[model samples]
Target chain A: MNCFKALLLLLLCTSLPAVEPVKLTDDGRMKFTPVFVDGDTRLTFVDFENPKVFRLKSMDWKTREVKVVHEAAPAPEFDPAYSIDGNYFSFLRTTGGLQVSLVIRNRKSNEEVVIAPEPGFSGYRTPAIAPDSSQMLFSFANNFGQDIFRIDMKGEGRTALTGTKGINIWPSYSPDGKKIVFTSTRDGNYELYEMKPDGSEIKRLTDSPYQDIRGQYSPDGKQIAFVSHRDGNAEIYLCNADGTSVRRVTNHEERDDYPTWHPDGNHLVYVAERDGSHDLYLLPLKD
Target chain B: MLNIGSFKTKTCSGIGRRSFLQMSGAIPFGLGMSGLGMVTADEVDHVVAKAKSIVFVFLWGAPSHLDTCDPKPNSNSDYRGPFGVIPTRTPGVHFTELLPKLAQRSDKYTLIRSHIQSAPGHPDGGTVALSGFEENPKPVKPNFGSIIARHRGFRGKLPPFFSIANGVVMDGGRRIEAYGGGEMGAVYDPFMVGASETGKVNIPALALMDDVNPLRITDRRQLLQQLDSVPRTLEKSKFRDWNRTYQQAYGLITDPTARQAFDLTQESVKTRQRYGQSVFGQSALLARRLVEAEVPYIQLNYSRHVEAITPGYEFGWDTHLYNFSLLQDQHCPIFDRAFSAFLDDIYARGLIDDTLIVCMGEFGRTPKINVRAARDHWPQCYFSMWAGAGLQTGRVIGESDKNGEHPITRPITPLMVGTTIAELAGVDSQARAEMRVLDGGRVINELL
Candidate 1:
């Protein structure tokens, strides 16, 4: 009976046409914090099979193969950004369990560098590389609170881009490389804000009672996707680049968070909790 | 069991008015006649009790002994970590600079630096620390509070014991077995009260308060009739044990004094601010009120979350990474402030001699810092701060090695703690033997 069931499942998977909001993991473990690249064919995410040993993993659905991007590292790595050519990527690494730093690694050369090392600060998070791959933007933390900082690719000559008193995190570089978008809590609640790459002419993009965090610009630079807890629980939300025309994207009673836009721009990948397990799902935006 | 508190004619003749008055006159002494007219041998010797109540503050996730109570500044950097050490009020003792409040007030308590747990995992260590027994598949041993409740029997309107936490301490699939009555059955279970993230007190069993008001029982006769209509089978089965629980619940609702024992609103704003505005601090304040009500045992769990470092959700001392940052930024500050306030409040209320305050965790963190800059679980050597109960104050009992790994003197076990608490609470060895609990438990004589 088990053999027959397995054969039936195989047949169904082969016969059915691909559908939207397709689950990409079946391990019955939490798989979240996903980033999509390579024309949305390849995906990278944090897999929590063992809650203690979180792994940076990648899966190619077309080839039906999975690989570990970082092996044997226990601390949480956050906000992985792939360069335009996908050859190099930059992410935030937390060591000593809570001290956060920026790590730029070359997957081919297998060499890694720790840039923008946290001296007296707690760490940094939400790293974004410029379109030209010449600089990186990240939120740095100190006793006063968190502010966004920019550094050159060589891990030298860091500059403070935002010196707000409250938290300013989840910075994303716009496609044009001239602008940066991020979330801030200066007004006492987390809201989206946009500023130039040099930190001039800061404008508030969103204003809501609920917390809006982890905002990312679309590949086409026309819309922004972010996570908000306004509707009782965390759900993915989309708005115009200027923060108007707001709409809910995915409405699961469970949490839907960490939405990462795909290269194609029509679809996005996010972490969704369903039936007690967290897995990655691909959802196409509705017109 | 229904006549557990009643007298039989086979013992003695009915007392006359003259004899009753004479017996009542001796109540100032150890005449053994309780307010309910029921007497027991334990009550006859109640004057010997060193402590009328105990506030067992369980630091759910183990804190680093080296970082808190047993700092090893002379050791290498791997053992010392980042913070510098400061001298306490005691001549020879010192604590980490992170615990400035405790350092300044170290004379108010006794620090046992050689306390050891049986196992290292959260559940195992918690079981041994609270119940004085290793984890096994069979019936779990009752915690000291459960045993006290059993020994003391019903005291008054309030339950004899209480566990103040949002919920039970949980680690994955397992939990702290000592949180309840354990093998002695649920009848002796400590009444569980939860303090929310917003610092509101709630009792899980009393959540179905739809129309029922403790202050206003609209139909007393109807309620009594329904209570009497329980089936005979249920009356004879384990369900019958709930009768006492229901009576206690009813009394807690209608009796203003009982309700006041759990209310934080009655405290002045300055008093509440002294304890800080955090949930753990508020829970400590509630524990103090329970002490005021003369509740025998109260366990105030710091945070239910044991492993992960998810701030604003749960707080435990399990620092797998960024141990220093977390201790500096969050854990130590809250504990230092709230605990200092608790000690001051108790002392000012003159409860210091009549109450026993024990502050410790399941175990201690590793002495040497791991590569993660966090300490792992180390059951070999830990520290427990004992105050009140007339224990010798401003002293350090036992010593850890230079590296803070093992004990250099006699090691203290959880069994000794259980025995000491039980003994101080007036549960004699004869009573423990009769109850078949703590069969060979030995009291820590040095603590006295």
Candidate 2:
């Protein structure tokens, strides 16, 4: 009887989802906007050098070794995304003041295309390249409200996909490029919404009274991962592509935000604050 | 730089010994020197010393009054923004949903909604906010903290005034000229200390030399032995005077009591967790510890810079772009958890009665949403939160118009703020007259 009971306990513990920290940043600087790259072996993210400087950094999950992706610059460079073929790279670079420009580079050709915002307090936020690398989508703020816009590889043929009265940001394309998921506050507070690549057939994904932001579609396009404050604190949550079968992934009292899906679709890399220190962590999803 | 002990140290303002001596000669050092018996609460005349310590929570980069504390829910969507309002502990008072924790704890403090400033930009506004005077005239006035520090003098090992931040607060690259002592000299400047989100305390002025391992700071004898080895450079008479100042500076790190006061490791895991784990949160906890140490004035800054979304910058309340998103995702959540924890901790420890807690920014943001769908700098109106030091709690002291554009009540200027803080901290009108500071300032009678 005792042997049988011990076996039951072992099976239960082994079946539980395992979460592992990618790196322990003890310097009190924040690491945010993690993106999986290099076939899931490496992750790229933004790191705060000081209170005034942010740089792009990449680290190997297996070796736990980190490297700076871009050399230090006066302005901050962040929100890095890579095309499916790894031939196209894109990120947002702050010009001056609050204005930011999206830069897209063809790694193979060594050519770049830059889309700078008009003058005044405006900038591109969270640029996500399409799976085919044909176009790049990002959010820009105007006098009325913020909306997502998409531009081709040559920074031409710009199209505004969202024109709501509130903020519509953090647009991410599904693996097949059939659907685009984003966060919007048009209905009231921030909530996740998914629409066609052409901004048609819009569907509200989550209806939480609180904020639900930074939505990213999984590699398989079967589920979406996002950060929601419905429980009074920011935590990671997972829901189906159709916005059903919602389940909480993290329940820490502190914040667990900025969820980015790994290439495997079975895991996520995110920024979590534990004991006042912010670091990246890898969380395995349970089926 | 003065090479005392084993390492070279600079003053918080980077003033050298000669400059220090020159300033000391100009001002009477008797009141500021150490070894004087503690000035008891009863010793102050006229105005009672209701508060023995003042924690000036400086929220740099003005926050939008409509989005956070002073909500205009009934206004148009453009003016009101996208946030919903919730009722606070004080009846008929509502704050935006971004500040749920603070709203719940409204009974613990008083909220003032009719603040106005002269300067529309950060640099000039910050100077006026800190010194109650503009930077246009030569010899800008001393910061409110410097005024109280000079009045209280030094009562213990810790400096009378402390600015808990990574460095002096700045807007972009321009440091606030009025951040430190103005005409009063650098000797009256705050002792600069940096506290990380994890509660590690760093004294920038006393940074160790590269050769010395920081872990060895705990060993006083070893540190002093290295200090003794430095070759004498000054003449015997001058060296004696320099040595006295050197010992006093090093004493801050060597003294056990002082070290304990700055050490966040002494706090329990639960207490640290309560404060949340952000730089501002940990700094707020450190400010509480300084209050316990009887430091006369502590200016705990939210961030050193004013810009929020700029690269290489910490999130200040300057929400020029992405105002609602940043507030929901970053600023509000961090502030709600950390500040609520601080208020609870201080009250639980029975320190509220003698600790004047004032939290506000240099100014408020624009009431109307801007072209970017975010708020811009608006010196016309803002708000402040005051608690402890015998303040009437659970009440709204002033009112703003329906649109929150201007004050419906009498406008509360920065000068009045300095006067009220000084008066509560035992620096009476007569004392202000003697120092020739806050000359025309008057206290906010409603707060009393």
Candidate 3:
């Protein structure tokens, strides 16, 4: 489960040009949650200047062009996600500093409604839209515990997919919509887990002592990439769908997190810390 | 034997054992009368100390020191956080912009930037910060308030020591170790006056049942005393233990002073508005009233529970998630408004010279922000603001490194803080010996 492919690459040759991680954005602001790259090589992320003014910006890898798809909604908005068809967008908005509600907007109608938590729900974070854009899955924590849940776009058909006794977060749907991958602390420390859409027959993917969060599947759904703290600091790592052939992706001293797979599945983009500023970087997985 | 042996003995200030005996016109040096034994004025100078009372605002969850008293503006974005630095009334001293009010009133307090409590875990750190010792070795060290209560005893109708909250400070499942009597015994435990955000005061320890009124409480007390009169076969029983506790509760319920002190309606509309309507704000107002009531020691807990992640939930200084946002939106603004008004009210009311005010959290957040865009717990360095109690005002003591990670000057530990508080509150050497806590605790000479 713990294979150091990068160490092997280093041992094989010392003269090869360094696999430098590419910087995508130079802005020193926070790279908000839910930074993802779609199948079209277009990357989307919330550029957080502050709660009052944040923008969901996207950059095309092929053309090197950037644009803001939407401005953050009123109040503090975080973890923005765009629907596959680009008809709807979803994000988490906190009222006060505590009660969190999922906000979904219909682009065509210019209408928005807030999905508040049930009576005992206390916290919500990292909302992700389904591939079909019909349902949204997110993680919510209460006084009792934390788990992941899925709800329809109309605020109906809410289901607790993973109701384990520990924190489960960052649930992402596979491209085909048949499987879901997420990070869970149910086994003491954060590790990746893969399960069916309904959350049955779960299988542990990466078993590392340190935190392994934001486990995302590739566009082809053959591999999973996540951020691991096994190296004493957060760095990106990739593993096969069956939890084998683990390999390190991004190697940097400062913290690197939220890795998103490119359309070609051979490249990965993630937020990396350089000199105290957080910026997105594109890594070429050509080794 | 007048059966007054259980009462608090040992005269303090100009009151207590000697005063009670003198006031009662009892025979001098009567036999079989025993309690705190005997003490000389020289041994009990702490009783006549400068500070008549202390209001310890324990910010249970650690706030980021970089964002509070010790701001590093020259440091880059990572260490400086999101807020900018503002000049304080003290020349060359600046605090994060969130604390503009505290900044303006900097002339009234001593801002110590090199405070450190080594335990990073919430419960351990909170306990040490509040009590000056670790929670291990069975019974933990008594809190500063408990020690003060033990030596000073009750002054009037009000309890000697009081905590403002339903319960003591807790983080998740663990409570702070020094929240109660600890090694000094349960008699020193604070009589808590709980308050919600709406400014309602409820005393859970003394709260009578819905059907139990003042008359009913009296009836029950009489019945219990009657039952106690029926002599038991067991010769060594401590059944009479309820006498002092019951008397205190009855006095609180019936005394107009106690009720009036807790009543917020008595405050002027402008005064209440100045403190703001948040739970912490109202609690600060309550602390001022308690001071007027002459409570020797008061622990004004900012939050009932620590580690509150969401806004509408219980509030604490622990900002593990979204540290900057929460501070900007809720924690900082409330503290800035309430604390500033509290300082002004204390000074204007002429309580400043006698009443000691100390505000601080258990620890502090890390120097560098984490990947989650929030700061984690860093116990190496933090800050505390001290005012009144004859302390040197408009002064900044000690300094942290450039990044505010570690103290560059002499580090002030919780032990020093407890020692200073106890010494100023008038807990003399004799009382500290009796308490048996803070054995090696030394006062911060610079503070005095």
On TM-score, the leading prediction is 2
Minimal lDDT window, size 10, model 2 chain B: B4-13
CAPRI class assigned to model 2: acceptable
Model 2 DockQ (Cα-based) = 0.27
TM-score of chain A by itself in each prediction: 0.86, 0.90, 0.85
| DockQ score, prediction 1 | 0.02
Q: Candidate 1 on A68-88: residue-level lDDT in tens?
A: 877766565655777766666
Per-residue C-alpha lDDT of model 3 across residues B24-97, encoded as one tens digit per residue: 23322122222221111112222236888899998867888987888776776556664546778888787776
Each candidate's lDDT (Cα)?
0.71, 0.77, 0.70
Q: What is the lDDT of residue B347 in candidate 3?
A: 99
Candidate order by decreasing lDDT: 2, 1, 3
Docking class of 1: incorrect
TM-score per candidate: 0.58, 0.82, 0.57
Quote model 3's TM-score.
0.57
Off by over 4 Å in 1: A1-287, B1-48, B209-244, B305-308, B311-315
List, residue by residue over B1-448, the lDDT tens digit for candidate 1.
0000111101001223354234323333222222221112122223246888999999987898987888887786557654556778887678876687788888899888777756667877788888888657659888889998898887777898888876676654467887777898888887878653224577655543344544455577755654566444554546645665667766676667888887676777567656654557678888999999999999888876322233222338876445664575457756887788899999999999999999998888888766444577887788998899877678777777789987655667788789888988888899999998887787776666
DockQ of all models, two decimals each = 0.02, 0.27, 0.04
How do all the candidates rank in terms of TM-score, highest first?
2, 1, 3
| Model 1 lDDT on a 0 to 1 scale | 0.71
